[model samples]
Target chain A: MISPVKVWRNQKKIQKILGLYGIIVSWTKVHVPPVGFSSQAPYVIVVVKLESGKSYIAQLVDWSENSLKTGQKVKAVLRRTKNPGEEGVIPYGVKFKPV
Target chain B: MKISVLGAATTKFGELWSRSPRDLVMEAVNEALDDSKEISLQDIEAVYVGNMLSGTLGGQDHLGAFFAEELGLHVPAMKVEGACASGGLAIHAGVTAVSSGIYENVLVVGIEKMTDFKPEEVAEALMGAGSDPERDAGASFPSLYALMARVHMEKYGTTEEDMAAVAVKNHYHASLNSHAQFTFPVTMEKVMESPVVSSPLKLLDCSPISDGAAAVILSSKIKKTGRNIFIVGSAVATDSLGLAERDDLTTIYAAKEAARKAYKMSGVGPNEIDVAEVHDCFTIAEIIAMEDLGFFGKGEAARAVRLGQTRLGGRPVINTSGGLKACGHPVGATGVKQVVEIYRQLKGIAGKKQVKGAKLGLTHNVGGSGATAVVNILKG
Candidate 1:
């Protein structure tokens, strides 16, 4: 998932930066029980691998059903996900097929 | 017996530049004294002061003693605390003292100076008032309200938009109130877009931490030739302090019971309330208060807000002085400050936010959700 700073700083600029890296990702939904439904939609919890070879929990966003698998490579994008007055999202669930 | 508010005064509702807690108290106390026609410091037989967090917020103990010395009043001065409802409770104490014939005129002041502490420390200190010190070791006040917001969404189908709409409406009203802490208007989009402090609750939905004071002089003696707002009814009730012990999480039981008693005493119903100043430490709390106070039907308060039915021109305008959401909730001063707004509206002194033909008004001050509650009815 992209960072909130990236999503908020420059949506178009972040998108262009990710495009150069050939990364594609989309939103998806996940459900963890006990608490009821939320209008904010489901979230995708992600882990990212970096140059240090350490992985961290990536950002999550609401997504639809049955779009992801166990192991997938994707790039993040900065986009407006919810209310206009809010900051843009760095939905980790947003993933694209890695070339 | 009706209690007349001969005079009312409040210090600015935010952090002070060069004032101590006692200074804030004196500022408002002096104003109230100035507003009174014939009342003097010597005429005040007793004194009641409300303070929420002197020990924790400002590291001061025996606060009443310090404040009384500043006023040069050797009269019996005592501090009354009911969490956030301290100010209202102090007023209630003064009213009882005068109406019981023990004293003809009584002075009540609510004061808190909180900017002395860092924001995080203040939050921790305020949260301590709500629970057994051991139980609240891990949770903050926002987390408690967040849990309630979750339950409200599940039980009553309340939406985040509905919550944001409350912030927008209150901010708009606050813009008209010159004394409000946040005098800027906010939009639903703006509320929703603001960074989320807790799930389903954002920065806009929460009242800011502040430092201020308020005072009201209640007299049992009806003025021979002057005008004043009378307190026809005042009722306070207590509920289980712990959230886990309550029957429900979405509603405040003590507030409902106290409101019932207040209405019974005032001989007025929900429809007769021209204006109200309710505790809205969080946007969800106000939504819950509308239903609990019987201003709207259960589960419909959010809709009432979205439809603009609680605005200035609506059937019953709520929080015209910006409420705790926009008006700074200075802990001790909040309850009396609420009464001050009601008095201003009933007397037609609320400049841009006054409701037309407002003969009756009410103020609801609840402490730590449902633990302690005070409901007062006012009439001109």
Candidate 2:
């Protein structure tokens, strides 16, 4: 489980990147995920070149095969990063979706 | 450059359920001491232990002191960690100590016990080497390498079959290795048909989680005998922890930089390296390493590997000990085991897997995606 304090501190950072536009530089579909991410197995993760000239790595949500290619336009969205288990903070983070 | 590896030894690499960390260390260290007839445990002036997941999985840290006590030593000891490059870093430390004239003899051991935890737990702990954003995206180690594989495929027309050949070749080499995790050669078809851990990277492309220990004795006091192996180069380089931050996904700049430094220090170009044990955590990783290490030109490694240019009979034969793919990757133990493999080869004692007239050898170890790399050159 993620620390509540840490999650809280990361919220502001997440807010800054929210709704940002980007282009996919590279992508991969994670068939096997680590702990806390089993619920999202087989998720697409992408390296996105953001409009602000920064690069980010995040899950590509609401994606289809057509949207999973290099240079695909995407926008960052707020979403639950992982299952926090029982009595843990529901951590939200930035995920990219086909723009 | 004056430091020599007086002795090197490794425990079997695999899911050794019966062995504890203490058991593995004692076996490897004692065997290493035995290998160097001129040295004993009492002669070790310092101890450097390399480990990655002991505290995360086993909830035990302070491995340097822990192993020192286990070996009945009261010398100065400390643990070294650089994700998977922990072992290589520890060896670098030992070389620095001896070359600096701070100590004449030192013990460096790399060990990891991963079978004790669930696969997911082990996967999660391994991500400690990666960036927080990568972990937040639920990226496992395979996924990280898979990303690179996808880009390589698109840019160079590298095929899944090319990657599969890497597994087939490494498994073939592993078949000749008694201590390998997988002692049977795998067919290319078998590797291509294996279940995908991540797209473009099948189960066969990834190294198995293993339990093992490797120990090496470094000494400047050792007499220069006919069979003595000397460390000609020891260098490390670091880069961005996350793949997204890298300027190019097709290369690991840290590895390139480390290899560059190692070559310059040893005054031995890639052509002179008769044998090499490179980090093959993933098939794509080996391909990229080949290019980064200057053994092959950019976008040429996949084809070269598929053509058997890196096989046992090939020039500068790579991963003769099965590499991490078939030899088993015990994280921390891999870097040290690479050194042990080269030491054996240089000493002309690496039976069956020995490279003929191996005068010079190199070992490459990487941590995280491309965040850290350690390169070492040895001369027989």
Candidate 3:
């Protein structure tokens, strides 16, 4: 029997803020895989508060020693993460880079 | 009907390679049974078991019944899950049962077997406490707290050095605790230089995962025992499960509200608390909790620690059992183990780390990034 598939309303329209200026709220240098997830060690994981008055959790790209601070200004870029499943199908998400 | 702790026991908390969850539970149960022989197995009318991630890590659920049957008991039993506050919640249930006249004797057990899985898998299971988007994006549990630590640093001028100091203090206390997982005294320099798990939070700042269990019996037949530890206050509160949804990220509303309710119920203010066992899953968490519990003003917990106000003989002697950071967090068993410490301290059998004249004690257990907070007060 076929059942009607439901789709997300997307009513809370998330405004993707690429190249938007944001400040770091909190961050961690992820050194190991979390659960079933894998990660390249020492990657800077951050929570960025966008100028739009919204906050997001993201990974930092182009990171450098002493580059990321609590109030450092950063810009978000659409980036790709490793494939969630297989077949090299990767998903694009926002990642902050020091501006 | 009043509720009081009839007996309490905890396994030596640490990485137990030789034990399973069931074995740890039996160990704690037998100890509790021996500690207070007044309440026997048949006297236990029902059981409330607390556990988190057992289904994922131990591949088991229906734990309350499993535990009851494992112990050869014939009574209603069930599991309670409130992230890291599971043990606190279980005791709350037991207290309610005994206080409401529904049962004369109630049993509460909190257990977790974290070492059954490999390190990364354990990290994955711990992510169950985080926001869906955050966890899906690969934010580990420590990262969630690191974010909080960052905001705290930005808002209050708190330093990484202050965060390192918490580890130093807890390790000193843990050195006195035989059941502590990490009994060695850690220095501030070592904590600061330790490999960073999350930027301001080092590996030493976080709690170690271990296998352990704790149990307590709550009874209304308090007159039979010449001495007693009364459950004076019990309260639990909740907040937005996801941090993004909260109006304020700097403060945990659940803890604030729960502490408020417990204090009100017990008619005991923060100044009156003699000793306390707070959930210190991370060093920043301890600071936040002390402030939320009204022990200090907002953003002042760090300074209070720096002043040596929270040491064993200091102000209220917080985390005399070394806290999760040193005592080891079995997750589910943490809350109950806290009560065991308070109980022992109140009975004057806490050995070396005993507060000089502690008469009032409090326990604050938090679940998942402040999503659930349980506060209980005891008076001797």
Candidate 4:
């Protein structure tokens, strides 16, 4: 359950990283997830080193097995980070997709 | 450097459903006092409690006052939190207090009650140690370690079998430990066949959520007796909260730095450590800990572990108490338990798991994914 104000504030920061290009540094498939994330079980998370020389960790969305390898090119995108329960704020954050 | 551990004790580690946190604390603290013989509850001038989840899971805080009152002691007390390193940090606090001449004798206890909640809830609570970004990305502890394991494998040709060897050896050591969570040995096949919690990390590779407590009595009043165990070195270091910010994924910089400081402070290097108890929250963690602690070179710990170089009868026997893998990881209790195990080894009272002629020992404790590390060197 995310605070609506915190989610709103984070969205402003998320906008900066959106659409940035990066290369994968490392990756893993999460078979077990924490609360508010069970709906996205078995998701791939990657460490990406952006072209701007910054590093980020985000879910590898719209990916294939081939896209999970190290050094794979990726682009950051906005996605729903968690499933907010009824009357809760739906938090959105940066995720990566194969370039 | 003047701090000495007068006594140490730990309750059995496992899913202790019947015991409350107060129950566990009483047992561990009383037993520790009994072990000291010369030191009683009245001798304790201050108290430090190390814990992680009492507020989030149990809705209770102010553990220092809570435990102090529980033991009927009137003294200055406070709680210490550094994720999983809470216990080690508390021990460090005790050392600092004694070294600063603020108090002669102090009691430090680390405890947690994790079995009271569901697995998912516990997993979520544990993530409080990590960054909010990691939580948003749904990266559990296993997934975070799995990310590191993949990098180590790609760079060093480390295999799952190599990681499984750690579980096998630790479980074998656990079989000799009466207080361990899983008092039975596990085979490589069993570990290899266990369900994958995260790719390349199986169920057996991860330490179980447990409930227990460990306590130690630190004193500057060293008796004239020849068998006083001293804390030769104590140090801690911190790094980025998330793995993404780290310059290297294969090594924990905090552990390396903390070990370096501790070793330098103790005037003892890796080769001189007769026995050790390292944080093995995950199989990959133990492997990386060996490298970070300088027990083995980068990309060499996996093979050395597979070759039985750290096993009992081997040089500097590691995790003789079965480690977190089989000893049960009660988060806050783990770091303190590591110290207790080493204390027993140095006292030559570890029973079946004792390292023969063990004179010096080390304990390593880590919080989150390489975020914080605490290292302590002990000599008998």
lDDT of 4 by residue, B1-380 (tens): 75789989999999999999999999999999888888989999999998999999999999999999999998999999999999999999999999999899999999999999999999999999998789889989998899899999999999999999999999999999999999999999999999989887999999999999999999998855547898999999999999999999999999999999999999999989999999999999999999999888899999999999999999778899999999999989899999999999999999999899999999999999989999999998
CAPRI-wise, candidate 2 is: high
Give the CA lDDT, 0 to 100, for residue B303 in model 4. 92
Q: Which stretches of candidate 3 lie above 4 Å from their native place?
A: A1-22, A50-53, A62-67, A71-78, A86-94, A97-99
Candidate 1 per-residue lDDT over residues B70-166, each given as its tens digit: 8888888898999889988998898888889888888899888877777657765776556431121123455456556766887789999998888
For all predicted structures, in order, the TM-scores are 0.79, 0.99, 0.92, 0.99
The candidate with the higher DockQ, 1 or 3, is 3
lDDT by residue for model 2 over B1-380, one digit each (tens)? 65789999999999999999999999999999989888989999999998999999999999989999999999999999999999999999999989998899999999999999999999999999999899999999999999899989999888999998989999999999999999999998899889989887999999999999999999997654447898999999999989898888999999999999999988989988999999999999999999999999999999999899999889789999999999999999999999999999988898998888999999999999989999999998
lDDT of 3 by residue, B160-271 (tens): 8887888899999999999999899998889988987767688999999888999998888774755688889999999977665666667899999999998898898999
Residue pairs with colliding backbones in model 2 are: none
TM-score of candidate 3 relative to the true fold: 0.92
Go through the candidates in order and give the C-alpha RMSD of each one to the true structure. Answer: 13.2, 1.0, 3.2, 0.9
- Pick the winner on lDDT between candidates 3 and 4: 4
Best by DockQ: 2
Error of 4 at B374 (Å): 0.1
